[model samples]
Target: MLRLGNPGRRISVGLIGMTFVLSIFAGRLIQLQGLDSKVYTAKAAEQRVRPEKLPARRGAITDADGHELALTLEAREIFIDPSVVSAAKRDQVATALAAELGVQKEPIMAKLAAGGRYQQVAAAVDPTVAQRIMDRDFKGVGSKHRYRRDYPGGDLAGTLLGFVGSDGTGLSGLESTYNKLLAGRDGEQFVETGLEGQRIPMTGGTLKAPVDGGSVRLTVNRDIQWAAQKAIADQVKAVGARTGSAIVMDVQTGHLLAMANAPELDLKNWQKAPPEDWVNRSVTDVFEPGSTNKVITAAAALESGAVRPESVFSVRDNIRCADQVLRDSHPHPMERLTFSGVVATSSNVGTILAAQKVGDEKLYGMLQRFGFGVKPGSGLPGEEAGLLPDWRNWSGSQRCTVAYGQGVSVTALQTASVYQTIANGGTRVTPRIVAGTTNGEGVFTPSAPGARTRVIGERTAKEIAGMLEAAVSTDGTGNLAAIDGYRVAGKTGTAMRYDTRCQGYCGYTSTFVGFAPADKPRLVVLAVVQDPQKGHYGGEIAAPVFKKVMTFALKSKKIPPTGTRPPAVRIRAGE
Candidate 1:
């Protein structure tokens, strides 16, 4: 081994090396302890400080006439933090909470004794009950205010307005469709806390206030909605039909004034009701449109220049399409009739013959233009765009069958839209339900206005109006739909219902779709009753209801009568 001559110098150098390492470790400790506050502050905030959610108020739903349909109010929720209760007194707390909350004592005792740090027992208690529970002064029990939705209209527009869920979210109807606009942001608070997680004194917390949601204004007219609901309820109950739907739209604006369905539900308590009652059948359900679809065929023919109101055809003497023989309800063998006469009698044979002249291409184009087989874009959830088989997909005899409103399907709103098209001078507009919003200051911010798209020319629309008028005259087949002092134009539809039993058509659906004051129309009303007991004819079951509703609607609106008489048509020997 070699001996070092400078032992003192070597010792000093080693000591200096050790001192530098210790200084480096001390500097790192100071950096971690003092330089970064966000990390330590966040860690401290997470351990003892409990984050509390700031509740927000939901938006309101109003009618076009400024009537409140749904609103939200401040409500209280009672809860218990079981950790705060002493083990000896835990039984007492459980018993008191169970009786006050209407729950069994055993469950309450089990929950309190489970020893979870922050356990909530009962929630959503009304203020009276919440106050009573708080009066006990139980260490663990407490109450907090929350926003609860209320529907003042009750079942008036229940299905349309829809209901909200427990998480303060919109679940259905206008609520679900406009949920983003209805749900407000959640605000939170972080407070410095003590040993038992109790908020500390002199330590201020951070809070961000919640922003409430915007309001929704609907196109519904409350008075008209009430009247329509009453009439439909009375009729549906009288006839004993399974269920019914009534939809009224502004003929001029294409705005859905009222869309009502039965049986109605209360939005406040949706859990107690059957799931099926929550459906808005007016837009979601599809059925064979029946003769109510005749207007479509007639419009196609007139617009395509294939047939005229005066054009004549030989009504079936029995026209056969594959296995089905297309015939009028009351066959007048080899009956000669004009295009207008075909619709007046709702002659299936005549409509099909006219469809032959118009053909599939023109008919399909017309249906597409009129918004059939497609969603009305009303912004409601679960809206089914009724099935419309492509013209190319149509099989043997399919074209003819589709002519008289068969081999196709549509929703009530789609059927009504076709009539609203004619009533609005051939321009089709989107059907709307929500009107616009109004601030708490009573300043109304109307929804973006609807646009008009021209579907048929002015002359063709006028001729179509004249033909519809002729159908409802005292001498015509739809005379049951005629109203006194008003020239009403409408069609009655009796279509066979779809059956899954034999996997073929089984029952029938009675439908009436029409607009009033045919000369200068203002309102378009559509009512559908599924499977009436005895009388199934649309003319019998649906037309009179249509008249009753139209008469009341006109009188209610104070609309003056159209003094002009329907155009006269001369019958030829062959026609």
Candidate 2:
């Protein structure tokens, strides 16, 4: 084995082995430098560069005439890298940021003193203030560009406008409903960053430009909205109610001009409000429609040819419906009243008599046609399709009660739509809040009109309108809903509100629904006050609110009163 034989052969093999090893190394070098160089280079660069987000601007929500309800403004998200700042300079830097940003120094100091590479100092800071902090050029202090959602009206349409979160996402209300439309596509920018997530100055990388979101134009009118909100808020407070809602609808369009609620959410400080107050109660909360549903029963009777406006009924103070006894709103001697007068008086006994003529199926069918048991589709989030049990399943009392808007539930928006149907000549138009949307290029595209269905005949609607007009007459239950110099038409509702906590009827839901210039119907306004401590009657509580809001709306729109006299309807047989 130690023969040292073939020394020349061994030497050649050794050289060949060395060459093979070197060839392998050379091939690897070529692959790294030539074939996959871009891949490797990118990996190396990726370690050095970090991606930064470029937030897109959220869309503006405007009123009908282009008044801003909600809008986006440029802002800064100020953050800090504590490791970069020296201990001695921490307080000084924190002080400067706090002073310039108008924030308390203690919070900034607490954040700065913490041992970390990064921490948020403040959010939604003004750009100008952020710039001032940057001018100092303190180490570790940085500001990122972001959009801040601004509410110009504060709590004006707070419940309707909803609010945005710190992460720039819509959280509730219309914000949540049309979030995709309001939130635009975000973009990205790559910048050279150090190992500590700090952006290296002057080393620019690729950018993907952001696309800003489109704007939403609502059918809501600003002045009218303000008036409605004020009126409802005042009335709710005056009545000491748990909550209240008011709605104003365009008779011809079914467009919601103003939807107001009490105990409204403040868009500025939405977090401070109770979660229950966040919903749009106009379309969310449901209660027995009470006398407001009488119109539906009347329609059934007339449309089925079971009764006429002139048909008379001998109505007593109280009538028995199944095992339960139903009574008129007030006690009175038996009187001979025409069908119109029965409605004008809001007599449950009289209404039940009329419903008997229409029968259960016919009355239920009429209610369905008028949009009961269906959501109003007002484009507002949290809207409910109120409870309407099948007529066949109705109880003995419920059968009669449903005729006068009892043992059934309906939302304020739905109640208003009932009046809108009559006001619009028997056409039921789905309620809508949004008027149009504007694209990034500032081109506005109008929204398609709401779906319209004829729920009652024109003749039937006119007859109901006349009856409603009689309700606002001097002797009717809704007389207080009358407007000076204008023939007003409406109904009053005082329903026993079903409170879930009590598991029974607890308080009353006062409601007054009406349209002005009765013959020339322009607007339908509904006022509802729930669980009030002061008063419960619709005429006493809700009607005044309607008059106040309707008056403002009429003058606001310059809808002059039609000077024609209202035709007299016989309430008494002799008359």
Candidate 3:
């Protein structure tokens, strides 16, 4: 009954409603196309494009012989977008991936079940394994390019070469010292991608090329280093020593031929090695120089005109300095001995008496000039400056103890440099291990040789060399250090290992330092064995090590023996 009003009125009402609906649709179109177009377009583009990192390849490290110590190889990192994988296919996908990656299924399953958009399944996987997984074309699994460090030499020179971290950063040794030079700048790349995160072929993208790192060339001679390492390691084990170190250097140039340490770390698996095995003990550890330090006192005495090599001394087994008593390594009768004889025999009592004539200032000055109490400037990290109290702080006992290498400490490298100075004719040159660096462009930049400072007169150096020569002859304390067909000159030392807990001596550190072809010294080798249980004397434990290393070094350098006989000198208690 209510529908009877009119068809004309109904048609008018319909037209008005239609007009209002059209207007609303038109207004929304204008707002979307004009007012907010940029915001919507930017969001759409962001979803389509993703930026990825372009990793840079790290540099290589080589020895003087161009043998590879460390380098980087191409590796793959596998990732998964768990959100794209279905629960029904999860177990099958994880099994296949685990088989290809050589990993357990549990870890892969855990990552698949993480319920996240992205997860890393494996890192630093071999390229072949990654390729196998990619060949399968799994629903959510893929791999990206990466770099991993490789040490081909295993544990050889491991401490010196150091290792890299999981993030591809250098962690120690030369790797850490020159990290900036070795780690080049990383670049970037942008790629258009689909909704499922797969790269779209022919989609527009941008890229910035990466710069590869520069290579480092060291002065180490691998052959000589191998020989030295073998010699020291065998000797240390034979003597039942805690640890040992040996250094061979070119006397004239201060280039370290070889710096070998025992208890080395395996560079490939350094993470499993103890922290102590990764230390370069030659530069980091310090101990008293023992009788080997008497050379410094002799140089001081001769330079100060307090005594000559021919000067006579009335010696005794022990001498009193303040309340403390200083004694030689062994007891001897009262006798008259020349200065040269005292040094050849390593007479601690005679050295203290001679040191008294020069006093503390002159002796301390000589020690500083010899590169003790300071880092050798080898550019190695964590180098310690051994303890050398100022002469002004020297107590009566300190002065006498220091005269024969007590109350002071020095590193193995510093101890080697002392003899290198005399062998290089009294000029102390800074030791260098890195020969130079090479850039990506193949341009080499040589490292500057260390500055040489004259520590004593040339004549004084020769006189000391001659006295050292006598010490290695049949008559003296270092006779075991003599090499056939080579006039070797060196000093033997056995110092008490200072224990902080006891605040006194607990063990002995035996050392032998010397050079071969004495008159024209070319190589200076120093061997130090700490806490030897079987034998404690330097002549017994350390001297033979020195001889073995020096012999190999001399032969490796192809230096012909001087073939000259050692000069005649008297080393008896009375001369």
Top lDDT hit: 2
Candidate 1, superposed: residue stretches over 4 Å from native: 1-48, 86-110, 192-204, 331-333, 438-444, 567-575
List where candidate 2 sits over 4 angstroms from the true fold.
1-47, 104-106, 194-202
How would you encode candidate 2's per-residue C-alpha lDDT over 198-282 as one tens digit per residue? 6788897658988888899999999999999999999999989999999999999999999999987889989999999988899
Ranking by lDDT: 2, 3, 1
lDDT for each residue of candidate 3 in 508-537, tens digit (9 for 90 to 100) = 999999997899999999999998999799
Query: Which residue pairs overlap in candidate 2's backbone?
Result: none
Q: Count the backbone clashes (under 3 Å) in each candidate.
A: 3, 0, 0
| By TM-score: ranked, best first | 3, 2, 1
State TM-scores per candidate: 0.86, 0.92, 0.95
Model 3 pairs in collision: none
In order, the Cα lDDT scores of the candidates are: 0.81, 0.91, 0.90
What TM-score does model 3 achieve against the real structure? 0.95
- The worst-scoring run of ten residues by lDDT in candidate 3 lies at 566-575
Candidate 1: the clashing residue pairs are: 217-435, 218-435, 497-507
In model 2, what is the error at residue 184, expressed in angstroms?
A: 1.0
Instruction: Flag the better candidate by lDDT, 1 or 3.
Output: 3
The stretch of ten residues in a row with the least summed lDDT in candidate 2 is 197-206
Q: How far is candidate 3 from the true structure (C-alpha RMSD, Å)?
A: 2.1
Better of 2 and 3 by lDDT: 2
